[model samples]
Target chain A: MSISCDWPQAIIGVLLSQNVDLVAHVPDAGHAALIRLAEGHDQIDVVTLTSEEEGVGLLCGAWAGGRNGVLLMQSSGVGNCINALALPEICRIPFLTIVSMRGEWEEFVPWQIPMGLATPKVFEAMHVEVFRATEEQHVAETVDAAGDFAFTTRRSAAVLLSQQMLGAKQFKEG
Target chain B: MLERRTLVDRLLRHRPDNALTVSSLGSPTWDIASTGDNPLHFGFIGAMGQAAPFALGLAMAEPNKRVVLFAGDGELLMSLGILATIANKAPANLAIVSLDNESYGETGGQSTATAGPTDLEAVAKACGFSQTCTATSEEALDAVCDQVWTAKGPAFINLKIVCGPSPLVFPHSFDGATAMNRFRDAINKLGQTQGSYGRSNESEI
Candidate 1:
């Protein structure tokens, strides 16, 4: 059973503490609450992207322009951003992304499985540090640690919201 | 069609001190680099279709400075919807120039959609660009310069050019971290000098 709630509020607090002003995403139900919180914040400028890869470039641009940013996406969007990850990897720009998981616990869709399982390995292949948030208390601290580690080291980092914590998406059974 | 290197050199010669530049991968990157490099120029070494979105973000971040992207037709096609994304955001400081050579000039010149039925300028206009032009000649290019740089944007320029064999021109440095720092430092300095880092239009930094 999943007990993690208030993860969205906790994540937003982490972003604010790190002074992240730009937030980009391709809308996903997993991230809906967190996205709204960012949008509601006066200091955070929200960018809705056509694809996930665009967020990678946009955040790097914000960083180059002397601002901090975050990208929120789902596990499937990870496949769309593999090559674009080269920007941060090759350029060594500090990057942070929060990925909400799919295809775990009680997955209703089979298509989300491959990418969901491959997500961490894909990020690791690109040398981006990966951290997982499996418990309510760990979500904010995981993000805080990843953000600090990425910015301080000028390296890329990602925080994965586990299916158990996020509560697997429920679809009606016929 | 215009010669790309000649056209880039000419346009960049007039690039104001307050402007920022982003270049897409391959020929467009080489074209911008051939004109001579600057710390303000953030040329892409490998992010193929990302130049436009990156430039948009920069423009949004530093609305006081003009941020222009020089991209290739083939690369732009990979993410044409980014034009719509930029249009929606409607950053006044952003401009995108597609160096339309009608092919992937670096990869032995294979044809792109622009060679067939694609009209990028029309695409931009359809995507909500208020100022757009397809410059087929030097005269046409010259006519659009002022608006491309100074108009209420976001603007799009589709510059038609023949795919000529140009040498690989690298940016000032290949070090990503170093390049990023140089760009960040420059942006910070501009914000300080202009007193517009977190001006009224932008959220407080």
Candidate 2:
């Protein structure tokens, strides 16, 4: 069932409802609005990571301390996080990642395509279940489901926000 | 000038039993493990450069307890940006101690950037860490160790040591799941009796 909503707002609502205490990210175009929302949330501690891999370790720390966290990153950033993903899988720490897609539809940057195309497979290889939200109507529900799957099952889960939903980045001429 | 393991032991000596510690995937892990296996200590098997970030999260999670991170110079260099991230969050209960042996002792004594001239303490100071220091002598490290565990932090200390092999002491259970579950159990048990509940529900585990 499709529900009409602003995707970022809907996803942020789910994150808050899920009681995410920590939001760690290396921002991407698709996650910009969500990042702002997380930063503004009174209960959340927003951590800006220099590299995507650190987000993995940070989330594990949150779990160790008896808290929950969500990691936000772009498709290319997934490649950087591949190795560290082992932390969640091996330790059985619940983890949620909201990935904004690129290089799939109406793509501008060629470099992003390789990772975008490989992102799902990469996560699957790391044993993180992947959920996709290609349409705005599915964004909130998809995020809710992803968080449930991660936390309830004590497993790694990722929600891929489609490039179509985000609108491809436009290259501006200087 | 300082012996690596000796300094590591000294730093951890007299630390509170409840404090959480995370060791990088290198000699620091072995050194810390050599001191003893407390469920409070997390020995990172493979994730390099994540010690500080891990400790930062733990500190935020358990605001009342101190969290310490032990990492090698090479590991810290790989994720130098973490200093900025830690500074930005500025968790009061977190301390990061970098074992600057001037070389990648685990990979063979290849000189690291710190050997030539990369001062991690200076980098940490620039990143806005208020309690940043480089301890070259045993007495100096003793003084720094006191502040590391007790002082308001986001504190960072770089301990210069001679490069050498440390005897490997693996955590009894290499299974991350086993170690992690036990660690969480310890925290939960503490919460139940101490009247300071950790983030977990008693029944959850």
RMSD of each: 3.5, 2.3
Q: What fraction of the genuine interface contacts, i.e. the true contacts, does candidate 2 reproduce?
A: 0.58
- Native interface contact recovery, all models: 0.52, 0.58
Cα lDDT tens digits, model 1, A27-115, are: 88889999999989898899999899999988878777766788999999998988888888777677899999997878878999999
* lDDT of every predicted structure (CA atoms): 0.84, 0.84
Residue-level lDDT tens digits of model 1 in B122-205: 999999998898988988877778766788899998899997698888877777667776876676766553323532111222
Q: Write the per-residue lDDT of candidate 2 for residues A61-118, one digit (tens) a residue.
A: 8788788889999999999988888888888888899999998999978988899999
Off by over 4 Å in 1: A1-5, A172-174, B191-205
Clashes of each: 0, 0
Candidate 2 chain B worst ten-residue window by lDDT:
B193-202
